[model samples]
Target: MGGNHAATGAAAWIAVTASTPIAFGWYPVSDASVFTGALVCAGAALLPDADHHSGTIANSLRPVSNVVVKGIEAVSGGHRKGTHSILGIAVFTAIAWALSLLSIDTGDALFGAILIGPGIMCVLLVAFALKALKITRDTKLLPWTMSVTLAVLIAIFAPEEWYWMPFSVALGCTVHIVGDLITTNGVPLLWPLKFRSPYWMRNKRGLELDWMWRAGGNLSLPILGDAGSVREWIFLIPVSLYAVTGIVWALLDQMGYDTMAIWYQIVAALPF
Candidate 1:
């Protein structure tokens, strides 16, 4: 899938999952959390690829990303290896958990702020262990780790909201992973232990934008599949429909026909 497709998939999944807990009456969530959490997760899903020099995300961070990639390549024996390794997962998880502490609404004592971050880090480590053991590979479940980590966060800070919040967050992120798996090369939903997954998607013929260079300034403006053929139009319609439906749904929901807003989803999911 293309970057736009992948990102949209992430957004749709987040919207669906975020609504799950709210609809089920788990906890009262401010819109900010929902938006923040979704974007955070979607960002994470897109992020792993940043370990690669030529990836869309890698360039944005530039020299720092370059340094990280070089370091990982030195250690993992190549660009994607070390960063994709279990060791790297641990490192990144710790970093993210430590960073998450900054989001807490209440202040902590000096020691509390410092030690608390690592404590949160420990919880994230445990979640990663759990996913590594139980979820199986190639499923969107890897992203579920984001939800589980958030669950631990909820448990500590908003105990009452713990029940369904993680479920919603995981669902959204997993859906993004699932969307990607539909393409030719799938993810190892179950990693370390179980191996790969069964999901397969039809890969794109050509995405207009190409990440030929890793230097932040080189990504090409994506050209839609050719504008000249019937086949191109074939890809265009569904793509157009997908984009428009999302827009329409947002409009209707804003217009107060929220219940009717899911019409696009039904159409998208329909087996034509």
Candidate 2:
């Protein structure tokens, strides 16, 4: 797992790239727009891990995620299988595109029902049957229950473009796959064929290009090991810097500042 931090970093990088003048030459972006895009990208980064029952995505979605995780595991023979493959990317992207085409009203209604119905029922059932079901002591369900309810409420009531939601999710999933490529157990980039990154990136000397191919595989940092570890830092730090710089430049450009001249001024002001 790239963990939340790495996943977020990847998403942030994507968001920053998308916010660039070059990337959005045909489109306009405001602060709100950039923020929304960033949020979507970050959320999408976690989509690939939907198959992992204990993962953040699964946990957030709870009961529904339970079913989804199990189903994916059963069909794919476990994690890092179908969902991590190129075919999986295509499938997810298609789903996102399709979802983007959904009528706002229809989508809101359906999502509202899914979120509210289960939550209300769960609340009523728990309240009435707490003692009867011997569930009085366990309060763990509350968090997920509340989360579902709140998420749904936000999804339905919040003002948003709506169409980009699915695309953001798809983008996140794609980022997850790319993030996994750094792991020791590289993703099945081409599933069914089961071609892992190591095999393809191996040199003629019969050695895996560990540095370039399995970068995350070598992480040994403490606490955030394997996720925001040293290896991740190597890629994340530079990308983050670039993203921040881009955001600043964009904002300055929008404000009518000569961003390049500003950069030169900052450099000139340095003690060195």
Candidate 3:
């Protein structure tokens, strides 16, 4: 149904992570938590797309996200300028986090520690970011809400493995943040602190064309600039290989886990 690239990537990442517990002996094939964890983690990774009114989950909650996005946009300006600010992150996370508390057995972790105990510190951090960016609202709250909801659902059901579920979900959100950051500039992940996380994607080669097309081939994204110098090419080539390597690794890991799941299923079904 026209999946988002970043969402698909997040799901694959969830699979990669969920499989690790099995690989490490923290859980078994029969564990409901493991299965639930895999499913929920995938959804959480894809949660940020709620910003798109046309998005699957977002479309379902048009009225709410529309209002939220509108309010945020009025307050913050537009994409990357406000909703990507710190206030946005906290407000987005708070609702999900509170809901999570009701459903899951939250533990202590970095995200949790920051979320709990005088946690106004973290919220203020996010708030300060929003204030600094002059960001007050967004046109895209649906995707963020949906993504965070999925994370909370996962947290409620996922079993404790390598780390806490909230932390894992928080980390998952970071992937979404970082994914977008690669495409745009002046992205302040944490606002109000005088720190700017500006990682841009404007190279003329490879996926630059595909990405550029999404922005309407606008002036901001170029077609073929210089392909950069040999040194830059060296950096670009290996970094580009990340896509290939990540795919292969995920595929092999999936096959291995599936094989294990099947074997265990057969054993459970054995007449002996």
Worst window of 10 by summed lDDT in candidate 3: 117-126
Q: Please report the candidate that would top TM-score against the real structure.
A: 2
- Judged by lDDT relative to the true structure, which candidate is superior, 1 or 3? 1
* 1 against 2, candidate with superior TM-score: 2
Between candidates 1 and 2, name the one with more favorable lDDT: 2
Q: Number of the top candidate by lDDT? A: 2
lDDT of 2 by residue, 1-272 (tens): 43443335333534434445324433334543344344345545655665676655544434665686677767765677777777777776676666444433454554432333322322322222221222332344764454445444544554343444445555566666766665445566666663233545555466656544443332211322354467766766665555455556656665777866766878899999
**Alpha-carbon lDDT, every model:** 0.39, 0.50, 0.38
Question: Which tens-of-lDDT digit does each residue in 1-272 have in candidate 3?
Answer: 11222333334344444433223333223333343333333334434443433443333234554565455555655444444444545655565566434422245552332223112212222222222122323334533454444344433343233233454345444544544444423235544334321233445455343333333222112222222334434434443344334344345554565555655787799999
Ranking by lDDT: 2, 1, 3
Instruction: Return the clash pairs for model 1, or none.
Output: 136-190, 137-189, 137-190, 138-188, 138-189, 138-190, 139-189, 182-200, 182-201, 183-201
Which residue ranges in model 3 land beyond 4 Å of their true spot? 5-9, 12-16, 20-39, 46-58, 75-77, 85-91, 103-165, 184-186, 193-258, 261-272
Report lDDT (Cα) of residue 37, candidate 3.
39
Which ten-residue region of model 1 has the weakest summed lDDT?
212-221
